[model samples]
Target: MYTPPAFREDDTAVLHALMRAARLCNFVTATAEGLMATPLPLFLDEGEGEFGTLYGHLARANRQWQAPVLGEAMAIFMGPDAYVTPSWYAAKREHGKVVPTWNYVVVQASGPVEFFDDPARLREVVTRLTDLHERPRVEAWAVSDAPEAFVAAQLRGIVGLRMPVTRLMGKRKMSQNRSAEDRAGVAAGLRQGERASDHVVAELVAEEGAS
Candidate 1:
């Protein structure tokens, strides 16, 4: 994350919020064989340690869990992102010096990785994860909704993951480096776009402008 001072996000609260907003994350680890990455849904427990702790699970047969990791594992959480066209920059018309860039928010957490197979702990992790994602639904489901035997069998097919986060890096590139007029143009352009994600980024850009 090569972040300039204007784009760096160091607020712990903001970083945690971004992590929670990211529904999925890319978990990466350096291994003797090579680097391995997995797309996973991770839950962060902010009260666990100085930074926080991450919890997730991987399929029992997934070789990533078996690989020997070096130092710390990284989880990349990407938030709303959009392509910014040069046409959206006022500087493009003024000096024709502006180039296209991207507007996005992301957070990366690094920590020692631990894999466990304890059934009790696995059950608790699964329940917490399920509750986190399901709480907003009208008919929220729970691990207790399923039969004990079935849930137990399902748990057996996966291994638990825990990473006590040691470092957190956050970046929010929302046209903060651009002039006010250029940023306003970007927000207007993105808000009028068809993609829902672009609209989201537009809101973020607008918020940055307000700040």
Candidate 2:
């Protein structure tokens, strides 16, 4: 991530918040063959280590888990993002020097990757993941809702992952580099757009500008 000082985010709390809010993450690892990546939903255990420990699972047949990692594995989490048009910049009218850019929030966690096939560990991971995502629903489901035999069989088809985070990098580019007037224009323009994510970015831009 080539982040300028204005866009760089180094606060651990903010970075962890972004990771928790992200719906999914891209898990990447460098291998002797090449680079392999998988889209996964991972949980962070904040109290487990200095940074945190990441937990997730991958399909047993996914070759990504079999590859030998070169050094460290990376998990990329993305937050709200939106396109910013030149028309939203006050500088465009001043001297026609404005260009289009994007506003987004992202975080990357890197650490040694470990894969396991222990049934007990897999069961715990599955239960925790299920509970985390289902908590907000009216009729929340749980691993115990399914028959033990069936759940055991299902767990056999997957492998568990654990990565104790050794490094964390975060970036939040919400028109922070723009002048106040230009940022206000961007917030206004995005708030009028149709996408829900655009509206989120708009609010973030407005909040940052106000600060």
Candidate 3:
């Protein structure tokens, strides 16, 4: 998260929006043995804490949950990114001093991590997570859609997590360090990229309009 002033994303609302849009996150923790990470689908409870709380789950057998990491958990959320070529910089033509770079958005959240295995809490967490991802679908599914015994058995194999986020670091590098003309060139180049992520970067550049 080495964000220069021109590329910093300090707005809480913007950070939360990026987190919500990022369906998957990398959850990392420190253990006596070593560092461990898991890619997980997480949901945010913005009203529950000063910054917010993260909710996710992992298999019961996953050693990551067994380790004591009450206050040393971090979740990384990555948004759209694009490669910036020197050709996209106006300075390249004037002085040929421009080099390639990357423009992207990311958020890192760290806080105390708590693990819960209680059946009731696990059930609630699972349902909430499912609803969050399924709400947009025509035939959304629910936890209760399965039989009681089946779902209960499934829950037994996993554990729920709650991380009360204490710090939030966000970075949005959208050609802010470039000259206005260079930034515009980068934006225009990204707008026509075949990758969907590049288009996203283009939109972010347009929104910021920073140089």
Q: What is the C-alpha local distance difference test score of each model?
A: 0.95, 0.96, 0.91
Structural similarity to truth (TM-score) of each candidate: 0.98, 0.99, 0.96
Our tally of clashes for model 3 stands at 0
Give the winner by TM-score.
2
- Candidate no. 2 TM-score: 0.99
Model 1: lDDT equals 0.95
**How do the residues 1-211 of candidate 2 rate in per-residue lDDT, one tens digit apiece?**
7989999999988999999999699999999989999999999999988889999999999999998899999999999999999998999999999889999999999999999999999999999999999999999999999999999999999999999999999999999899999999999999999999999999999999889
Instruction: TM-score winner between 1 and 3, please give it.
Output: 1
Q: In candidate 3, which residue pairs get closer than 3 Å at backbone N, Cα or C atoms, i.e. clash?
A: none
Question: Quick one: ranking by lDDT, best first?
Answer: 2, 1, 3
Which whole-number lDDT from 0 to 100 does residue 137 have in model 2?
A: 100
Candidate 1 minimal-lDDT segment of 10 residues: 91-100
Residue pairs clashing in model 2 are none
Best by lDDT: 2
Question: Where's the lowest-lDDT run of ten residues in candidate 3?
Answer: 202-211
- Model 3 has an lDDT value of 0.91
Q: Which scores greater on lDDT, model 1 or model 2? A: 2
Clashes of 1: 0
Error of 3 at 137 (Å): 0.8
